[model samples]
Target: MTDSADSRASLGDGIRFAFGTLTVLPVRVARWDRAAARAGMLWAPLAGLVVGLFAAAVGGALALLDAGPLLAAVASAAVPAALTRGLHLDGLADTADGLGSGKPADDALRIMKQSDIGPFGVITVLFVLLAQIAALYELYGESWAQGALAAALSAVTARLALTLASRTGVPAARPGGLGAAVAQTVGMRTALTVAALVVAACAAAGTLFGASPVPSAAGAAHCALAAVAALAAAELLLRHCARRFGGVTGDVFGAVAETAATATLIALAVR
Candidate 1:
């Protein structure tokens, strides 16, 4: 039998591998580069779970304190914004500026890489955040579990899009960026695993804590629609990126995944 100390060490390594240290695991287990990148896509929902729980508590606290719902409203977004350190938000900005620059495609790509923000990029990030805040504010009143489900699945759906980003037409910009290594590592099986889990979550949420028949039905519909839309959006983007850069890159994956999640959540919440 393994010694107690060895067992404990194994546990610690497993925790680090799952939690924040994605690169520590063996490359053969899932491939170091792909595993880390997939973590970028897959773990959003896990991040959402943590953030959603906090948001749910914040909303409940607001209800108790009689501060009104809006404060808690913004607070929900605070968690995700903090978790990603606004990495996707940066992608959103760079993508917007690059697309809108009207410069040659190569110049636009270069601009996205430059560590500067432009008028378009700044506006893009703010407006995107504003839209997210509004959608989440509406969802604040929903059950904590439901809200949590939505947050986690939204992130997962975004990453599902990332699988498509790497696999579909997008050619990598260069040999190295975030895109190249992942393109080799990410595969159909990993993506399909994500897809299966997303579906399971949606079904389970509806069966478990749905408020009313109508709302439950609506929630189920929302999840289905969100998944379809996210996938479609990812596909469209990969096609564009393939044509534009001759291949996808890590930044492109970030941009596509963020856009898909935001759009999916907004679409589901609003209608």
Candidate 2:
């Protein structure tokens, strides 16, 4: 095949891998090679964008139907969980349990692998969800556009965190499963490029939010800042998990994603 043809095939496989693994979308992954994993991590934000749009739509619809910001926030918060089949939340919970255990790396990994949620897991998940809902409520109260932008921004930010976590040099915690399949697959340069693009696009989108030019410019700045904050927060969690677990795992990826999403919402909620 020509180089162009190879590129097209690789791109297609990347989309499949991204949507198939990162989401509960119907896309069937056709390749599990490092090439595909690299492309998939690079494209993860696109999957997040789709999920964010769905969440925004649902929240906006609720607000339009005379539902209050609280309900709109609740609905928006639920959409990502529903779309991803709660996998990320479960990961956050498991990661909490592992970290809370404070055991050796092996024991912590074992705790994370267990299906049941422990006390620490339960409390952490509860607080995270509450924080997300509270942030969404504040944004929704400002305006429908504000709320919607936050919803979308957060989702994209979440996946962008995963992309960063998968970059080369981040080791996998185990020899098998999703972590091993994608860990250290993306280059640092590629991850940074994708992140910069996402932030630029989000800033452009935010400029459409407010009526006056000043507000619009502020909106753009806020959007950009929110992305930066989300990444910063997720990075902290990623580093902690890597050190604690001796490397990244599927649980770590999920935890990173949720942390980023929550941080985005919280940042946007601030006046």
Candidate 3:
């Protein structure tokens, strides 16, 4: 095969890996090697973009039918959960339980690995879901466009967090599992490039879609702010988890993704 064909095949494998692992999308992952993982992490936001668009469509449809912002918000918030089979949420719950346990790192990790949800997990999941729903409700109340933007922005930001988390210098907490497979697979430069692109696209989206056909600086700024805030919030969580767990885990990735998404939603919710 020519170099170009090899590149294309590699790209296809990456997309398959990303969607297969990050979503319930019916793509078959052709490779599970580091090369594929590297590509997949870089492509993570693209998978998120699809998920976000679907989420926005669902919520917008509900709102157009006059289901009201509350129902629309619920449906929008539920879409990501449904698409990913609630893996991220489950991670969020497990991470919360582990962190809130106030136990040693090994013990906490053990707690996170457990199947049952603990009190801390339950409470954390409840509040996080409430916050997401509440923020979506506020945005939907303002306009379906706003709600949809928030939905899409949050999803993209969530996956972007995963990309950053997988960058070089970050280690896996365990020797095996999804985290180990992808951890440190992405180069710092590659991760930053993907992140910069995502932010620019989001800002451009806001500017184009804002109040009118004419570009709106305010809309662009609003989106840029949300994206930055989401990254910052996710970064903080990633740092803490690294310190707490000694490195990243599948659960930590989930926790940071949810954190970024929630932060993005909250940032957009503010008037």
Candidate 4:
């Protein structure tokens, strides 16, 4: 009983840590060790779930208020940035600059660590953000419920990438920091379990929402496909990072999440 209680408490701490690290949430994490970091990653998708819900809510409210889809989409896009304080965006920028430079591993890593954004970073962020906003606008224009479901699933699947990236056999690019701390901490079984659960939850939510008078089999399929696509994209990015950067880094993880989210949203926008 005592051991079970301790495990429960630690799990709670891990959930708190996941939220605290990933978002601007007020949760305070009391522990900071490899064990805690690994535990926290298992719950990383929960943070995405929270962000997605908020984004969906924002889009829904604007739609109900008769706002234009473009405005609604922009505001919805801003939701994740606000919640995460643009942490993922920063990572996206850094990773772009690093990889685009085509420098050696050490130099690339150094470029990623710079405080200011470079030309490559600026271009990458601009294009990616615009793509997300445009895709979301199209989705919102179709149906508010569809838009919300897409947003939620995209966010969830995006963060799910982190779990895959942290799975055993993946290595850290450097000796210390977020990547090293959580790298290879997630077992293959754990990653697969989380991925399956996320995909299932998204499918269920999509089906439930699809039954709402309109009856959209496409919507349900889109949600499931988006989740799978996001995971596949993340895997490709992980392999690229391993080859280009020597291994995954904090920036690489962030880039993976953002890229996956964007890709999912784009897939949903497709007719």
What lDDT tens digits, residue by residue, belong to model 2 across residues 8-113?
Answer: 3377899899999999989899998777887888889999999999999999889888799999999999999999999999999999999999899999999999
Q: Which stretches of candidate 4 lie over 4 Å from their true place?
A: 1-9, 208-217
TM-score of 1: 0.74
Give the better candidate number (1 or 2) by TM-score: 2
| TM-score (C-alpha) between model 4 and the true structure | 0.94
lDDT of 2: 0.90
Q: Residue by residue across 1-271, what tens digits does model 1's lDDT show?
A: 1122222223333333333421222323322344454444444344444544554566556645655545655665565556556666777677777777888778888888888888989997788778766766665555444544555556656655765564423457767765675563334555567666766575555443356554466567667777777778767766776677666666676678667767766765665
lDDT of 2 at 150: 88
**Model 3 backbone overlap count:** 0
Off by over 4 Å in 2: 1-9, 211-215
Tell me, what's the RMSD of every candidate?
Answer: 6.9, 2.8, 3.0, 3.1
Per-candidate TM equals: 0.74, 0.95, 0.96, 0.94
CA-lDDT, candidates in order: 0.59, 0.90, 0.91, 0.85
How do the residues 1-271 of candidate 3 rate in per-residue lDDT, one tens digit apiece? 1222223337888899999999999999999878788888889999999999999999988888989999999999999999999999999999999999999999999999999999999999999999999999999998888898889989999999999999889899888989999898887877898899999988987885467878998899889889989999999999999999999999999999999999999998886
Candidate achieving higher lDDT, 1 or 3: 3
Clashes per prediction? 8, 0, 0, 0
